[model samples]
Target: MHTLSQLRSGKLKGIKRLDLSCGLTTFPEDIFSLADSLEILNLSGNALSSLPDDLPRLKSLKVIFCSDNQFDHLPEVLGRCSNLCMVGFKANQIQTVSAAALPLELRWLILTDNQISHLPAELGQCHALQKLMLAGNQLQSLPETLAACQNLELIRISANQLQALPDWLFSLPKLAWLAFAGNPFCPMPPASPHAPAIHWQDLEVAEQLGEGASGVIYKALWQQENPRAVALKRFKGALTSDGLPQCEMAACIAAGEHPYLIGAIGQVEHPDQHPALLMPLIDGFSNLAGPPSLESCTRDIYAQDQYFSLENTLKIASSIAAAAEHLHAAHILHGDLYAHNILIGPENETRLGDFGAASFYTPEQNLLQNIEVRAFACLLEELLSRTQGSAATLDKLANLQISSAQVTISARPLFSEIKKILSSL
Candidate 1:
């Protein structure tokens, strides 16, 4: 949030980071004054449409964000920044992406909420790439060259015009997290009769519980024959990185009942036509970890002091495995299978929530299910990293992690097999 006045007065000289959002329509030349120190620059929420040709003068710059701007294309000068690896231009009108605009050291790239319909084949040259966010775009297809990016771990291609899923995407060894719900291949499920619809008037909304990219949840009272406390979720109805909120609710309903799942009890009939869901209130529960940070890119962040006993970690892992098994059995893909989406109770009781990235698939689509196995493996690795102690159970868990992350997708064990092994441990 640095002001133009401070920058103009040279008060921000030698700073390692700079943020200017005062309706900037052009690159501030003064920024180059801190080239020796600046590492991160954020010009989001501005009117900028381009950058100077010599943006590479900032030798120390490593990360840059120009989101919520008026750029029609990513600046080619950005590619010249030798150290820049992370680039974000979310919520812009960018449609063209030049081969020269992508940096060689690129690791994380975010182009969410853009009008991009195509990507350059040179994107495959980013050997260090890890995370990619291209949701809410007009892309009809992705370049086949992207298959060369073996380091890619997380990708968001939901809410696009893709007609089919790329077969090569499922072969990426490191790919774990994926979201592709609101596309031609995958769509919101048809209405289900199993989930009873509760009218809006029957819900007495209380305090908001929390919110995510797709919707907001609140504590409420179901005003029925015997009023009972419940949780209500109201969809935002906008395109998110994971896809549309309706798809999330549809998948949640289709998921049905499972002990480890935060299954929807009923659908909400809002008078104003707002999409919502009702479920039993979860008492005494909290997230297992925080979402990833800028540096971590796609990994969850656990508390510094957080440590789990081998037994408890195994218990938590088993619960999530069972939940995933049930989801796969119902032809649902929990695109997001991270610990951050899991709520933990006092006795290590885990309830997997947040179906915002869930998508429906047919039985023949082993690619979707097997890709999720990599995600499950990632979760197991995270938990095993935090658990301390030595036992036969620990060795078995380690072996399971390796088997689940096998390079050959077919070699990876299914969630059911993982669940059985964990239960035995």
Candidate 2:
């Protein structure tokens, strides 16, 4: 841990990685030239307004953490870093990204909590890019060029000024996880499902996992025979929408005994007449919506020593697909499917949870009438969000050959298959 004053002379040649977060106000000149062999550098918690122009000279540099700085613009020299893959510039004053300033081999680029209002179209040239975060910016639009990135998996643009999402954004093939909360273009609709209620005195609540449109989930220690840990989902009376309780109950029962599905332990009715569900607690899991702040996503991803791996994402997708197939086979429809509803368990096991909007269908029912088009559109949006930027994967996920007007057919078969099973029943 070196300070700005100590780094003035560039005497730390032996150090492969350096951190100058203590009382630093500016970056020393020729810092990168001196540290030719540096692989990682941390200059967070500083007052620097901009980076040195010759920063790309550090050919061995791979990772850079410059969060909490005062940078209003990204350094033009960043494009020269051929070996750089990860760059964190969260909590800065940046307002835009120039197309020419992006590195070609960059895999992960985070610029959360900045003032960015637009993205350059040339960013599409970064074919090797995988994850790009621009949360907490002033962005009202996105570049259409992002469709060129074939390997891109995650693109977070939450809490911005976007009023309408571009049509091409939904066409990315490999794009998987997305969060656009607090955006006027895709506001959290008033159509949220109802949540069951739980009294404070009935169960001992531990840590709060998160809150959703329907209810709050808590890691609780139930006072049972063995005193086991479980996830307690409690609903707020005011937030309860029509048919939510019955839908949730049906989903819990229909999910049944699938390994990838979270087992419903039991249900408890409170004095207030609200119902809550109890299930085994799965650790190290987080919702895909992430945090409301884009800076939070950048900080989490840049902390590579602590974040989830790409392999974990694949496991989650596989498990969710399996669970959805099971529901389809049982003549049940998971009315909602997104990252927030999926959980990652021990040994990277993906478990599907939150069945608040699930429903059962019969052969006589029309698929178009039975499934809410708005809800189905939301699910398709979620799936398309994941496949964005990868033409091949997008084609596979959306099956573009089916035509945009008939995209609903992808989900129609699931219900059609279920209807056939119910006919025999």
Task: Count clashing residue pairs per candidate.
Answer: 0, 14
Candidate 2: tens digits of C-alpha lDDT, residues 257-313: 788888576566566767677777877865444322222322112122333443443
RMSD of 1: 2.0
Scored by CA lDDT, what does every candidate get?
A: 0.89, 0.60
Estimate candidate 2's RMSD in Å: 11.3
Best by lDDT: 1
Q: Tell me how candidate 1 scores on lDDT.
A: 0.89
Best-fitting candidate, scored by TM-score: 1
